[model samples]
Target: MERRRSSSCKMSLCKSASSSLGYVDSSMDVDCGSGWKYAPQVVLVKIYSFLNDTDRAIMARVCRNWSLAFEAGCLWRRRRFEMGGYRARTAEFQASGFAEKFGQHLRYLTISCNHPSLVTCKIFQRAMEAFLPKLQRRAKLKEFRFSRLEMDRYWRYEQLKEKLILTLTRFLRQQFCLRVLDLSYSQFYLSAGLRIIESVGLSCGHCLRRLIMEDIFHSRLTVYSGLRYKRAISRFTNLRTISLNYGYLSDDVMEILRGNLAGKLKTMRVRVYRSDPHGHRITKLAWNGLRRACPSLKVKFNFESIGFASDIIPILVAGIPLYELYIWTGFDDNSDWRLSSILNHVAVNFKDTLEICNFEFDNSTEMIDDALFRLTQSCVRLRSFITNAVLLISTIQNICELVEQRKLDPRTFHITACNLSDLEWAELAYLQEKYANMADERSIDFRLSSDLIVESRHAEF
Candidate 1:
């Protein structure tokens, strides 16, 4: 009777084991399906935010629910439209409901008409008209960037230019909450440019922080018109950064900015490309005015013409606490002594505030070892030091030693020259390897490149 009971228990144990295996097999065979389709809407939206335009389109086609969620999420907050000559189909536009969606959610909008297909003036005008009502409802809009790429050719068409100006003026008048307005590379009549400036000054003056008006031109306007527009720009009291590039900065404009912006302006970038020497002078009065008005202004002045350094450098060294200094000498007119003196003066005077120092000399005749060493030693806050001058290996060693001793954290240290030898490159590589191995908690980057190519990394030539 006991033997029979033991055999019966063994049989029952085998049956239980087989039933457990069968249960596991059946559970594995059950298809769970796509888990993403069942995810919460917020989780789906967060995932969709990482996708690019093409990827988002592909994801939308994955299923119906994903398409709806993608259309309603934060992924559509920033929209870029490439305006070619062709108009979007009416049915497609209506179905997409672009205006309704964008008006409710768009914070940034970029409209580009610089394609090869060449959108006609009338088509662009009609498109702007169709989108205007939607744009008017963008209460949360903060940035508006309009590019009429290669305006030199596009502006030749009178109808296109006029329509663009009208549309832009209308757009500007309504953007009361805009913080950034970039009209770079877009040609507009002097009147239209002034009107846009006036609209921003009156409507969004309290909120506007950055205004870029690069490559703006007025067909036959004189310096008087620029002076008038300067007064309009002055009304933008909260502007922190302003860039007037490519044929915009005249003496009168600079003077007006000095008197108007005063302590409010933080950065001013002026780039002029005229071959005539007279057009590039930012006179002593203007320089002195800027120095007095905005004592802590960061100035980036780039000109193809020479001879303004003598007038500008002393003022920069004297009063203004420059944060960034970029001097691109287009001509080989400055002496090595003059360049060294400028660097030394900056290292001594602006040491507390200077963060970026970029110098592109016409040639590599100057050896800036001493000036650079002094700068690295003095400027504890210097984050980026870039130069096109040839540097000695010993100088680089000194800089590294100073930085290590002071525990300085510089983001970028780059030297561009044609004279860096193989020995110097090897030394840089050794230093980089040593720094990488060191357990020191500091970020130090050393880069050496030739004049023909600009590359970075552990002694990557």
Candidate 2:
């Protein structure tokens, strides 16, 4: 009787297990619509990976949970505007809806239009009206950028179109949260645009941080005004990085920024386009502004026609915290030893914190070789170097030597040279072999491609 009872108990347990399996199988088709099948965090991550502006908008319709994902504050943190040729309404309609839904979440925004014309400005204004209210409600907008390159107009405008232009300009000036702004218009003169900027600078004093104005035609227009800059300095007490593209910045304007910054700035990059010797002098004056603004500084310089290298070394060495340097030397008509002298001077001083250096050359081979030798000796801890010029065999050897001496196990070096001699080819072959041997020990990459061909691949190092 006891044995029979044990058998019955085993049969009952088997039946219960079978019933559980059957229920699970039957419920396989059950919809997860109302259930917490996936966590909210997981859903949020999936929404973040949507490709384009349209994809981001479509995500709002996915599931009730996903619909709310677009409204999440994190999604609108950094807005990017790809302004293509006169800010089309189609683009604005799409972007503004997305921005209106999430603008309050924005912390950084980038705007790039195909053409930065009056029409583009109008479209931007329309989008802003749709989105800025929501952004203001959230009080989260922080940084904004306006980038454009003047190209041939696709649609011409009538000369009497002044009202539309004024309206668009007013919208930009009043859009409150544009704290840090970058204008790639490159044509900002000391005219109407400057006046608008100055007006905003004084009124919107609470938030602005950095203003970078680019590509002014200095020879044709003298637009840098001392009064405007001083006003800007007084208004935006938080202002840090202020850079001008052309060499038109007056000394007084430079001094205002320098005095206000007073040693808290990190990076100051200035590009001087004029070939005047005075232009190079202006570059130094800009650096001095940064130095005066901060007791110690980090600065980057790009000058197209630098006449005197000797004058720059003192200014550069003074910024002891200066690390990364990019110099574009077009031609060395006066001195062959200039590049060498500059590198040696830097190598002797800024050897500790410097990580990357990029140099572009339109100079003699001898001068290039001297520069390479000095670079290896100085920038020992450097991790990346980029150059488009044809580096000589000795220069290549110097780079390889630097790699060895610094014990920089893994380094990225980019060199673009189309035509190469037999010896150069041999050097490449040797470098390839060395790279192969160190494939697992370190990472080294090489690329040779045709202009029209596009291919993607991944290799395990």
User: Which prediction has the highest TM-score against the true structure?
Assistant: 1
- Highest lDDT among the candidates is held by which one? 1
lDDT of 1 by residue, 1-461 (tens): 64333223222222333233322121133333578656677877887788764455445444555655666637767877655445333322421345554466778877766552344544555676667556776546799887664455454676666776676677777788888888775656667677777877888877898888765544333433355676786677777888876345556776767766788788887654434223344455666687678876787655433424463454453444467767766665444435666677777777887788777765456666787778777778888877776677777667666656664557777766546665666665566555553323555466655554324553253
Per-residue error for 12 in candidate 2, Å, reads 61
The lDDT per prediction is: 0.62, 0.53
**Model 1: residues with Cα > 4 Å off, grouped in runs:** 1-39, 53-68, 71-73, 82-97, 113-134, 137-140, 148-150, 187-189, 218-227, 245-308, 311-317, 331-338, 377-380, 407-409, 421-441, 452-461
lDDT (Cα) of model 1? 0.62
**lDDT at 276, model 1:** 22
Task: Write one digit per residue (lDDT tens) for candidate 2, span 207-276.
Answer: 6767676552223445554455456545655566656553445556556656666665556666654442
- Work out candidate 1's RMSD over C-alphas: 14.3
lDDT at residue 432 of model 1 (Cα atoms):
56
In model 2, which range of ten residues has the least summed lDDT?
452-461
